[model samples]
Target: MVYELKTKENENSVIEFIESVESPKKREDAYRLLDLFTAVTSYPAKMWGPSIIGFGSYHYKYASGHEGDAPLTGFSPRKAKISLYLSMEEGTYKRLAANFGKHTRGKACIYVNKVADIDVEVLKEMIKQSVNFSKKMGQS
Candidate 1:
């Protein structure tokens, strides 16, 4: 069975969204991430769903035939933690992640309390790899 993708790119203002975040720290960190991601991905910020700020996008179809469009890299300034969304397979970068700094992670989302908790250099490398990985997958 095919599942519909709930998160999608929308015509929303990323700056506006950042300004709406309640926490002053989160809001500032959101702006920092916006600059960081934009500089790394070299793509303009785009909103994915109501919360996530995304960069470049690509389409993917799994072996099971599940397919959808997704950002190559993105993040959401959630109430609990900032969610860093990257496209590489979980654990595919264990060595790299070891130096990624204070964070918890799931399959695709990395949770961080703030930007200061992570090594920005490591995040940049991860974002580059993720963009390449997603682009390659879409080409297949």
Candidate 2:
């Protein structure tokens, strides 16, 4: 089943979750992630799922018989890591990741532990690329 978007409800939970993290470092990291996502997308950030703070959204379907709507790009601040979504397309962001510093990749998401652990400038470029990529997807 497709997950329903619960922007407001998720935002509240994210606020509470961030507040409950106990570690000031983690809380601050969450805030920074929030700031970066908000600044880059220019789309107001909203929480997705229990931990994900998402920005602009789009819908997609795959040949493998899967389809869904997802944030065009976003991230989650987990207890142990931060997750960034870049959406999906062939070769769109492959080169950018090389300079992104320490990170792990899933199908369309990048995971990081802390902002300081990566090259912020490169991260910004990746965010720009992802947002632009999403916009293009919307048009096509």
Candidate 3:
């Protein structure tokens, strides 16, 4: 059976979603991230699912036969922290994470409490690398 993707694009406005973030500080950081992602990726911000603000796009097919399209990079301002969705080789992620400041990490996500909690320059470098990787992967 084919699986459905929950993170497909929606018609909701990105600005509207960012504005809805409860914390004033988080809201401000959301806007900052939106601008930074757009500028770095050179792609318009688009709403992914109900919360994530995404830039660019890439298609991936995993070994398990799961295939889907996703933003090259994105972020969601949640109640506890900001979740950054980016793609980097494992070694690169580790190196960057060392300089990324106070943040948590999963296999592919970086979590920060606020923009001030991390190094924006490292974040920008990650974004640039993610976008370049996506392009090299043949994303349109």
Candidate 4:
């Protein structure tokens, strides 16, 4: 049996989704992040599934034959922490992780308790690199 990807583009309003965040501080950070990502990626924010606010896009396929198109970079302001989605190969993520301020990680996603706890500049760099990497992967 084949399983489908759970996350995909949706028609939900990005602003509304941010507004729905229960934490006022998180909501504000979401807006700030939306602006920053939009400027950096030059791609409008789009709702991915029900939670993630994504920018740009690229297609990816793994050796196991799983393949799909996903946002080049994105974030989701969850109840406990904000989830940053990025792709940093060649130990780039490790380098960033060293100076990323207070954060936790799981493979591809970085979790921060709040935007203020992390360096916004570093976050921007991560997003930029991820976009470039995703574009190259798409072309190759």
Candidate 5:
């Protein structure tokens, strides 16, 4: 089942999820991610699924015939790392990743340990690209 976005009443649960992280550094990193995502996307960040913090919304269907609505882009604060979702066609992020400093990509997701580990300007550009890509996709 698809997870719905959280409501204002669910804010406490979101806060508590952030608070439950054992590492202070990771907790702060998650907040920084939240801030950066909000700043760049201008879409109110909402807790979606179990651990994902998402911005905006879109509908998608895979070539295999699976279809669903989901956040246009999002991230997750996991135990080992932070995952940033950049919604783009396959291979579109390759050039950006070359200048992104220390990061690992899995499909559309970019994983990093800390924001400082990557170039923020490149990140901003990537975010802009992803947002624009999603916008265009939504229009189609």
Candidate 6:
């Protein structure tokens, strides 16, 4: 059997999408994140699916044989919070999460209500590490 991922990269304008964010603050933050992600990864922002603003992409396959391409790092400014998609070694994630400031986590995402609530330096470090890890993944 084959599986397809719904969130493939598209030609949508990232600025337009960010403009659509309902909250003024969220929209502002989205733009800030766009710049931050681009600066950190040195990659142009692309729209993934309808909402997420993504940077460079990487391909991955799980043990179950499900494989797909995904942005190396990305974020979605949702109504409740911004969801950050990043990669980290377990030990590094644990060490960084402590000093990561106020935020919640999921299996593969970090949720922050606003960027100001967390440490931007920590965010930058995580993004840098994730991009590095993803580049390595593409080589393997």
User: In model 3, where is the ten-residue run with the lowest total lDDT?
Assistant: 131-140
Residues 46-104 of candidate 1: C-alpha lDDT, one tens digit per residue: 99999999999988888987888999889999999999987675576787798999999
In angstroms, how far off is 27's CA in candidate 6? 0.6
Tens digits of per-residue lDDT for model 5 on 1-140? 76543421124355677778888998998888778878998988777766878788776666776656667777778988889888775575877878889988786588998888999888877877888888777666
Candidate 3's TM-score reads 0.92
Q: Is candidate 3 or candidate 4 better by TM-score?
A: 4
Indicate the residue-level lDDT of 7 in model 5: 24
lDDT of 3 by residue, 1-140 (tens): 66889998777999999889899999999999988898888889999999988887888877786788888889999999999998777788888888989998877688999999889999999998877776666443
For candidate 6, the per-residue lDDT at 133 reads: 86
Better of 1 and 4 by TM-score: 4
Worst 10 residues of 2 by lDDT: 3-12
User: lDDT score, residue 95, model 4?
Assistant: 83
lDDT of candidate 1? 0.90
What's model 6's overall lDDT?
A: 0.90
Candidate 6 or 4, higher lDDT: 6
Residue 3 lDDT in candidate 1: 72
**Residue 1 alpha-carbon offset, candidate 5, angstroms:** 12
Per model, how many backbone clashes are there?
Answer: 0, 0, 0, 0, 0, 0
Please say which candidate is ahead in lDDT: 2 or 4. Answer: 4
Q: Which of 2 and 6 is the better model by TM-score?
A: 6
Q: What lDDT would each prediction earn against the true structure?
A: 0.90, 0.73, 0.87, 0.89, 0.77, 0.90
Name the regions of candidate 3 deviating beyond 4 angstroms: 137-140
Most accurate candidate by lDDT: 6
Worst 10 residues of 1 by lDDT: 87-96
Clash pairs of candidate 6?
none
lDDT of 4 by residue, 7-54 (tens): 898889999999899999999999999999999999999999999999
C-alpha RMSD (angstroms) for model 3: 1.8
Among all candidates shown, the one with the greatest TM-score: 6
Where does candidate 4 stray beyond 4 Å?
A: none
Q: After TM-score superposition, what is the CA distance of residue 47 in candidate 5 from its true location, in Å? A: 0.8
Look at candidate 1 and tell me the lDDT of residue 12: 91
